[model samples]
Target: MNFLTIFARNLKQGPQTEAFPLGPAFTPERLRGRIEFNADHCEGCRICERVCPANAIRFAKTPDGMTFDCWHNTCVFCGNCEFYCPTDAIHQTNDWDLSHVNADKFDMVEHGLIPNQKCVECGATALNTAPVIKNAKPPLSAEEYTELRARCPKCRAKYLKNRKVPA
Candidate 1:
């Protein structure tokens, strides 16, 4: 009984361990989580692929063997690729929203894009890529067209024909 008490007291001399989740999650400001990417900055160089420990990042090659991908889910957050990026295209973010209910969500594409779409101006599928911006001018507000005799009969007839009804 005497030996047990002394042994227990000595063991407890160190700091008490705090309970995680309930107490506090141990993390830091610089803790790495999800990998970040800049599509325009990426030069399609495979330097990141060669150095990845987890084989997380990969390239989605086109038929002509052009790379256009930056997979984030399989990435291990080792920061090796981020450190070695010459173009500064890839970096690590603190985001931890990698959880998904569907298993299909984890089947990430290298660039995570839906291909084969037409470019508005060119009308070709070649320019199909991520985050397309329609460069066309925004529809003019009604108040913006408040003017007297803005156009001749020919122009007014065409404009009236294109006007949408409230119904």
Candidate 2:
């Protein structure tokens, strides 16, 4: 085909690129974009930190409790942390708009804190996270669950072991 003919065809087709900034960008359902952390659902396990290849996830001990931080700048978005989290505490969101200036680079972090709480029985300080009751044969009732959440890991284990099953 001649140049004029090709040019005419291209003009008729118009702009082939997406109208980003003016319109919303296409985000896939499974697109791994940003990291999200939920301290309430966390089991106080550091599996996500271990599985993160980029060393983006970090757990630090503070006076109040343990703090979790995921640095977006360092994160490779591999989704390893989300996959290895047993309690589904860490997951990825589809919002990929991470554009930022040089001044805001350090602020691009996902942070969460697991606050310390006193165990009802032992008075020992423990992270106020959801209790892991995987071994509980009979699902815990509302009252039982409330009691379980007030104890430390050791106390929780003992309570579960000594729980009397109703006939």
Worst 10 residues of 2 by lDDT: 128-137
Clashes of each: 3, 0
List the candidates' TM-scores in order: 0.45, 0.88
Alpha carbon lDDT at 1, candidate 1: 97
Stretches off by above 4 angstroms in model 2 are: 1-15
Query: What is the model-wide C-alpha lDDT for candidate 2?
Result: 0.91
Quote model 1's TM-score.
0.45
Instruction: List candidate 1 segments past 4 Å from native.
Output: 1-27, 63-67, 107-167
- lDDT string for model 2 (1-167, tens) is 59999899899998778788899777799999999999988998899889889899999999999999999999998999888888899989998999999999999999999999999999999888888877787889989988999899999999999999877
lDDT over C-alpha atoms for residue 40 of model 2: 83
**Which whole-number lDDT from 0 to 100 does residue 50 have in model 2?**
93
Q: Please tell me which predicted candidate would have the highest TM-score against the true structure.
A: 2
Please provide, for model 1 over 18-75, each residue's C-alpha lDDT reduced to its tens digit, 9 standing for 90 to 100: 6665676566778797777766555445688789988877666565434545556667
